[model samples]
Target: MVVTDVSRPDAGSPGTMPVRRKRSRIPGWLRGVIWAVIAIAVISTASYSTGAAALTSSNTASTALRLALPILLCALGGLWAERAGVVNIGLEGMMILGTWGAAWGSYNGGVWAGLVAALAFGALGGLLHAVATVTFNVNHIVSGVAINLLGLGVTKYLANLIFAPVSGNPRQSPVVPKFDTYSASFLSDWLGGLEKEQRVGISDVAGILRGLVTEVAPLTMIAIILIPLSYYILWRTRFGLRLRSCGENPVAAESLGVNVYLHKYVAVVISGAFAGMGGASLVLLRGGADYLENQTNGRGYIGLAAMIFGNWRPGGLLGGAALFGYADGLQLAGGGEAVLALLYGAVILVGVIVVVQLFRRQWIAAGLGVVGAGVLYAIYWSNDTLPSDLIPYTAHFVTLIVLAVASQRLRPPQADGQPYRRGED
Candidate 1:
């Protein structure tokens, strides 16, 4: 946000600029709506134009939702921690702990118990990070790395000690109960018949609406609700304001008599809770048979990416998560439809860019977009599509491109990594 002068004639320290630049003052709600519309336009054009059966299928939709929920939750976790002035790189470790906690809780109590246990374990991990970075003034990144190492070591050691004996597998745990799925075959058939695992009619708005309601995981439902819930709590409420302020400038918050350390601790602990929820989803998404050492993979890191992509906003986070999830779903479902659909989506984006440029009177930019669209059409006419191997992760490429293009629009807390001490201005 601070724009400084690099060139100065006499430069002990260049005085602050007297001139202030006007900035756009778009409301948050309106910005969200705009983002949603753009996302829908791009996704819709890709889905229908390419005949991406997998993208449209009920199974693909279900899978994407499932995959997106965990990532969204983790992103929310990162949002909480970072927004509170703590850079938490230990989300992966917290998630790993949640896997074991979920397994243990499920084994002892039930599915719900698994969730509670996951939260507890994640909270513990968060606490460790907070104690080191917040209380002791350790470097935040160093503390996070330590937590990750400790979590990995402890989980592996415990798995060998406990899970190996119980399930006869050192790397995996025994099965536990999982959530049930609901069916809507009639709706699918009525919606123009499923092309792969879904009915090939995304623009059939009716079908898409019905599809979301049916065959959904309970956790997915929770995650969807949490999106708006997070937005309301973080951006709408007074307490949320305080929380965000703490991240932006803890010293200023402290001057206002805010319990800076307390708030930071609370933010990080909450962050862990959300991450734990994500871990539970990972286990219970299927038949909760076992917890594997490598289940989390790099999803925790990806979640951080999603948060940045969303500009640290909840709704934006949802879109980013959904985009990533869609890619994974196509890969899981395995088909050519997803690949074709992505190409079509690219074409749609090209058109959108050209239209926006034309409206803005950017003739050169508009012309380039037109040219790009023409090339895409030529490819379509020549019978071309994205490679099958790349279909599964097209979203990653999109995420990177988006981040590059809109980097200026995205901002983090001004004091995100600066250590705060009491009585300091």
Candidate 2:
């Protein structure tokens, strides 16, 4: 009898290749859109059921966008550095320097000058980081910590010397010029009128759109433009490919005649520029026309978290920022009640997860998802209001939960944060 192993059909065939089935899955962008639609539906239902008008209010959306901008910029900064295999834990410090630079320049020149100074100062910070990590080969984390210390100490001394002399406050800078904001006059008016009509889904959509077009700042517009620009430069352009190569494998990149050090230096510098722009946004937009001590208040750290949550992609980073911003905005717009509505939305989201896990035959995960959904639903049913203290930290709590869930799927650069020297095999 001839024994032919069906499972080993290609075992003895050296030149033959196995034909595998191609699995069809949803495109990433389309999946994102589908998830977004589900989230919106859940939140809209929560808003109506709970009578939380602020959940979909235009003012809340505006506040969320304003609050998200700084985080978005900082995350972009981190993305640039990490993509070049340079770990930048000094983003907070760079932002500090930018704030001081913005104040000094705006005081001396104008808001535009302030922005230029911020970028210059931020680039300086990045340069210092590059000198420590890339040139001297210091531990990336240690160098980052030192940069943070240096940024804080240097900015403090400068603030005392420059700001105190003018404002008579060591911790505060003198009044700086504020940037003008634009709104679509007739269109914004029409949207506002439509939103005020309060026609459930239609009104909510109108309200969200109105917020986008109303009182929009030039910097905000520029920041939004940078998202797509960064995507194009980093994913489409040859320079981006070379830079990213340095992060993935410096030795391999150098073998291919790519300038690893130069690319890293450029990336770190651009990182600092983005961080500085974030600081400039605070001073010029929502910071009461002046730089204040600790105005950042850990926003740089939050931006880093946002970056990680996004899995080092610009689009993901934007979503993370928007999520945190919306949570905070809900707290600001309607206090505890609005946030309570988020709990209901969370329940719906978890329920959807349970369904997905079940479909995938992930029995254990589906069970956990069901429990989580049940617990969240119970919380929503029982609590009419979240505690005052907890409400202030709503965004942070949401960030933590999101990071925990997203942690499973992250795929960072292979050589990220690894020390590399030229010609070292």
Residue-level lDDT for 279 in candidate 1: 83
**Model 1 reaches what TM-score against the true structure?**
0.82
Give me the candidate number with maximum TM-score.
Answer: 2
lDDT, model 1, position 113: 89
Clash totals in order: 5, 0
lDDT of 2: 0.83
lDDT of 1 at 87: 91
Per-model C-alpha RMSD: 8.0, 4.1
lDDT of 1 by residue, 354-397 (tens): 67667777776677666656765665566555566765565465
Give each model a TM-score.
Answer: 0.82, 0.91
lDDT of 2 by residue, 1-425 (tens): 23334357554465545554467898766766786777677777778888887878888888888888888999999999999999999998888888899888988998899889988888899999999999989998999888888988999999998889889999999888978889998989998998899887878777777887988888899999998899899989999999999989999999999999999999999999999888888898852447988887787888888888888888888877787778777788778888888777777766776777677777776776666667667877888788999887864564464345333357788888998898997
Worst 10-residue lDDT window for candidate 2 reads 399-408
The stretch of ten residues in a row with the least summed lDDT in candidate 1 is: 192-201
